[model samples]
Target: MSLQWTIIATFLYAEIAFVLLLTLPIASPARWNKFFKSKFLAYISGQASIYFVVLIGVLILCLLDAIREMQKYSNIESTDHQHLDAEMQGNMRLFRAQRNFYISGIALFLLVVIRRLIQMICELAGLYAQSEANFRQAQSATVAAKTLLEKQGAGDEVAKKDIEDLRGQILLLEKELAKEKKDKEAVKSQAESLNREYDRLTEEHSKLQKKITIAGGDKKDN
Candidate 1:
């Protein structure tokens, strides 16, 4: 029984790990287009949450079935009970240990999901900070270029050269600003994806709650 349980646990862990490994591309900014990365990650996270609930429910059902079977085997045959047999007692202990192991494994898997979520948040924060710094630097460079252009006189050759240099500087700053805008757009796209996911999950939860309430009322009426 222990060996069987060990094999089952190993298989479940491997499957969960494989699903988690698919999230690796999310860490790379280059992997993000307008649609793929953020949407994919949100989908995976939402699916993971759904599966987590399902797996927990299955685990509980399995536990309840096991307990029911154990009770059947433990039925007293006479006025005085002899207690459960040694083998049955040992099997009970094994079942309990395996159940605990499975519960712990599921908890660990949840922690992995949460850790990945936190890591993603931190990465976004870092990227936002970098983008802000780039914007400020670009703004300062633009101000410097305007000041230089204003101070120069249009007649002197040296002043013409200075103006040309400033013009070049301003062009470079504009290119940098364009790049920053692109990055900002990418970030905005991701934020919108997250918002859409939040709305979807909220709607799903509300519907689920209503279904549960309706089912409970039906059960009481029956």
Candidate 2:
């Protein structure tokens, strides 16, 4: 094989190996995403579109050349049967052309497939990251709710204590009011007894004065 054809064969084999590695589940999507986003790959990816176009164009040209070579050799083999040596050389050339055609076609196909696989891996990694963020948000919200409930419970306890204090104050005021009412009633009873005693003393004094006046009148008449 010529040096050019050997190099193409080697490139075709490499493409096949890369395709197999992508299809196999050896690495996770996140790992693949990280690898593709690395500095070296990112630099290569920056010019990936140009590279893709150039590679595809070269492959297409090679495929067309191979097809033309195959057709030309086939025509020569069918028409010039008298020259057996020439016919044998033509057959070998035809075989090489066919091989080249297949190699180029397969390499082109695998290139597109590799690009699609990388895109899919990147999308899957993004989805995983988004889901993790949502889960964290949910956890934070749950924590906030728990804290709010704790605060509300503390407020309720404080309100209950205040209500108990007010009830104690009311009980004390009722006891003081009852004691004052009893003292007022006792003072009223004492005042009524003193008034009655003064009335009885006045009546006795009036009777004594009347008796003295009656004794003096009897002496004067004697």
Candidate 3:
């Protein structure tokens, strides 16, 4: 039982040392700024460091008291079984106290470690969510831009088709204009021909009238 108690004490002290080492950076005022970004963290670290110091003092005192008790017990001569039983009872009480102290210390250390881990996890998750939101926004913008471009392309195609239709209409109008001009030229040529025929017939009629008058005069003289 004594040996077991000693082993438990040794293990508890070792665990305490390990926890202290792990907490050293958090507890150190000089190093606090490196890990913590908030005043709240600073305040929490200060409080936690004070608690850890008090717990260390208590554990040290308990270990010292346990050592003293063990020394005293060893010095006692085994006079009788009743005395032995009393000593055993005392030892049992000490063991129980030491066990409770070790358990509480370990629990406190684990709580602090777990809290820090959870904070880190939450921070990481927040960063990931923000990045994912930004990425989704960018993706949505890209899709919208693509959709806008497609609409513009469709508008351009429609405009080109309208331009082509306008060009075809212009060509048809030009052909009709050319045909009207050609018909107008044909009508003007036919009118000029009719005017020349009227002038030749009037000249022939005047010559025939002169010949008839001369013939009648000759008959009268005879």
Candidate 4:
């Protein structure tokens, strides 16, 4: 049981680190994009933030239960029940870590997460705009490519114009693809940050639950 939590803690930390490092920059450009522009993205982020808040509540309940159980276990055991004592210590550490973490997460959700949500909406909006532009460009390029084919043996002007149009279309697509990739990276970064916050919350929740169990146990014995 102890080892399981240790593993969870380690994994959650790494997840947070990876996400924040990658996503925060691309969407940072307020001029390039404006957040809250995409209602869908904003809504999704809001839902996620709320989910975390609910999770924190559940953790509190579980924590109470664990503390209660611990009380009984601690009192009923023999003097050598050092195992219970040690486990109790471990549980305490988990609880403190979680309490601190979730508190921080709540702050972040208010500030960073909400901000990120806006950024995501903006990014999506930008991508949509870019896509429409690309479609128009592609249609124009297709017409050029067709005109050139119709006058296959025509002057250099016809051949050159066709080639130029095609080249422009390809370049435009490349730029669009690149922009799309950047947005994906930005999304990844946001996910990573959220994941970190999630881990912290989960750990804290678990710790509180253990305490609640222990506390309940103490009550029962008395």
Each prediction's TM-score versus the true structure: 0.34, 0.75, 0.53, 0.30
> Lowest summed-lDDT stretch of 10 residues in model 4?
28-37
Q: Runs in model 1 with CA error above 4 Å?
A: 1-12, 15-49, 59-96, 99-222
lDDT of 1 by residue, 73-111 (tens): 445232254556855565676566557456445645655
Highest lDDT: give the candidate number.
2
For candidate 3, lDDT tens digit of each residue in 23-44?
5554443233345656776678
lDDT of each: 0.66, 0.87, 0.67, 0.64
- Candidate number that wins on lDDT, 1 or 2: 2
Q: Give the TM-score of candidate 3.
A: 0.53
lDDT of 1 at 62: 49
Model 1's alpha-carbon lDDT is 0.66
| Model 3 lDDT, residue 89, Cα | 77
Q: In lDDT terms, how accurate is model 2?
A: 0.87
In model 4, which regions exceed 4 Å deviation? 1-154
Query: What digit string (tens of lDDT, one per residue) describes model 2 on residues 1-222?
Result: 788778777888898888788779998888889999999999999999999899889888888888898898888778847677777888899899888888878877887888888889899999998999999999999999999999999999999999999999999999999999999888888888877877887888788888999989999999
* Candidate closest to the true structure, highest TM-score: 2
Model 1: weakest 10-residue lDDT segment is: 28-37
